[model samples]
Target: MKKSVKILLIVLAIIAVIAFPIIGTYNNLVSLEQKVDAAQSNIDTQLQRRSDLIPNLVSTVKGYATQEKDIFTDIANARSKLAGASNVSDQATADGELSNALSRLLVVVEKYPDLKSNENFKDLSIQLEGTENRIAIARQDYNTAVTNYNTKRRRFPSNIVSSLLGFEEKPLYKASAGAQEVPKVDFTK
Candidate 1:
């Protein structure tokens, strides 16, 4: 081949190589975004499972602990807020509210020894605890995805594709204000 033709072929090859990295970066970003979505879905599944358990819990508690309107109302309201949450921040806030409400409800339940020992309530509580653990794990997975995406979007080559695609940083799950406090569990009378 002529010298000019060979030079043109080399230039085309270089352009293709350059294009490959950008394409790969874009694909990686999309995959990372999907992982984040999947993690969020797992968290939601746990939250929904916990939510479904509440009605039975509330009904059981009411049968044993009559006139505890405030605690029940708080739990219902928190559930409503959680159901209505629109974003991660909203969900987090609602989760905190629910946690606080559940904590209060349990504290009040401690007064009723019969209720505490009731097999159904105890079973529900155990299940709720397991769901909470699942939620924590799911949240951690989501945060990991967010961190990975954010790191890529802020770094050199991937940053270019991330910027082009308008990828934004995602928020991580955080402990609520009340959650950070040490429990004042005074079991001894």
Candidate 2:
């Protein structure tokens, strides 16, 4: 073999050795980002399902307790906030608000024996509970995905490729403060 041909082959081999890792890192980041996005989408879907169930629930409760206007207004407002949320963090915040509103509504329902016994109200309540559980699972999945993506974007080799490709770190879905506390309901009005 000619010396120049051997030199050309050696240079090509070196380029391949370096290029392969960069390509792999870029691809891996893309995959992680997609996973994060899919998880967020799942959360959004569950949130929408919960929002859709609100009107039926409100109507059922209204039939039994027409005087509880304030709770209904609060729930409607919270649903609006959730519907208008633009990002994962915003959605999480709005969801917390909605959950609080729903809890208050449930407390109000306890004052009405007739509403509790109604078939439609019971069905809607069960559906809302299931949707809430799904939302919780979806949020957990989202947070997990965000954690994985952020870790990859912050690591050494992957970070270098991530920065080069403009891959930003995703934020985790954090529970709002006081989320664990039971909402207090006062009927002194």
Candidate 3:
């Protein structure tokens, strides 16, 4: 073989070795980002399902406890906030508020034995519970995806590819400030 041809082959081989991993890293980042996006969409879907169920639940509860106007109003405002949310952060905040309002409403329900026994209210409560479980699962999935992607994005070679492609760290769904505290029950109401 000619020396020039041998040298050309060596250069091409070197380029291939470097290019292959770069391409793989880029593709991997893309896949991770897509997974994150899909996970976020799942969360949104669950949130929408919960949002859709709220009005029915509220109306059913209202029929039994007409005097609990404040709790009902809080739920409505939280629903409005969630509906108006345009991004993940806003949705998370709104969702937390809705959950808090729902908790208070549930506490109110405890005072009314009739509402607890009503078939429609019971069914709506079950649905809300199911939707809450789904939302939790979706949030977990999203956080997992974000963690994986962020880990990859911060690593050496992959980080280079990630930065070059403008991939940024995604925000995790954090619990609300007051989420850990148990609701104070007022039996006098």
lDDT, candidates in the order shown: 0.86, 0.90, 0.91
**Model 3 ranges off by over 4 Å:** 184-189
Backbone clashes under 3 angstroms, per model? 0, 0, 0
Candidate 3, residues 1-189, lDDT tens digits: the string is 699999999999999999999999999999999999999999989999999999999999888888888888988998899889887888888888899989988999988999999999999999999999999999999999999999999999998888888999998888767777786645565
lDDT of 1 by residue, 1-189 (tens): 699999999999999999999999989888998999999999899999999998988898999777677778989999999999999988988988888778777886888899998999999999988998998999999999989988888999888788878988878877666766543423333
How does candidate 2 fare on TM-score?
0.96
Model 2's alpha-carbon lDDT is 0.90
* CA lDDT for candidate 3: 0.91
Which of the numbered candidates is closest to the native, going by highest TM-score? 2
How far out, in Å, is residue 101 in model 2? Answer: 0.2
**Candidate 2 lDDT tens digits, 1-189:** 699999999999999999999999998889999999999999989999999999999999988878879889989988998889887777778888889989999999999988899999999999999999999999899999989999988999998899888998888897666778898778987
* Model 3 CA lDDT for position 96: 88
Candidate 2's displacement at residue 111, Å, is 0.7
**lDDT for position 181 in model 1:** 59
C-alpha RMSD of each candidate structure in angstroms: 3.0, 1.2, 1.6
